[model samples]
Target: MLSNFLPFLYGISVFVLLILAAKIMLNGFVSSQASLKTQNSFSKKKKDDRTGLVTVHPELLNKDGCITDEDLLTVRFAKDSDHPQSSENPSE
Candidate 1:
């Protein structure tokens, strides 16, 4: 009975190792494929000279040594009409 159990345990270990090896190989293959696809797509795109160009105004930079807080813009959201205020609790 001991000899029979030893072979069964060995078989289970070998099966587990095979599964782990297959999983690692599959992950590597998938990552490599994804990297290759990204490289190919990037190469197919046309390089534009103005694509990454940016224009900045010199006045926006701080002239003094200290930092100044400039009020650039203000944004306000309009109230939604779908959810009307309940008059049951007027104090709230």
Candidate 2:
């Protein structure tokens, strides 16, 4: 039984190593691709000549259009009836 298990164990260990190497290679490729994408996105933004200013437009705001997190905190949440409870368990 011991002799029979040795070859199977060796094969499984080799397979596991191969899988780990593949995962590392795939992760490196993905990381490099993501970095390149980020670089391309930044490069595409047209540089402002007036003051050499780089500005990012805010995605969320009120009617006044103040670009700040403090502006968002000013808004009030509704009563207990407005808050809905989920039926599904999040931990699972």
TM-score of 2: 0.46
Per model, how many backbone clashes are there? 0, 0
Candidate 1 residue lDDT tens string, 1-92: 99999999999999999999999999999999999998788778855444577545565557773443574543445874565444356774
Worst 10 residues of 1 by lDDT: 65-74
User: Where does candidate 2 stray beyond 4 Å?
Assistant: 46-92
| Cα-based lDDT for every prediction | 0.75, 0.74
User: Largest lDDT belongs to which candidate?
Assistant: 1
Error of 1 at 88 (Å): 89
Which 10-residue window of candidate 2 scores lowest in summed lDDT?
67-76
Give me the overall lDDT of model 2: 0.74
Candidate 1, pairs of clashing residues: none
Off by over 4 Å in 1: 46-92
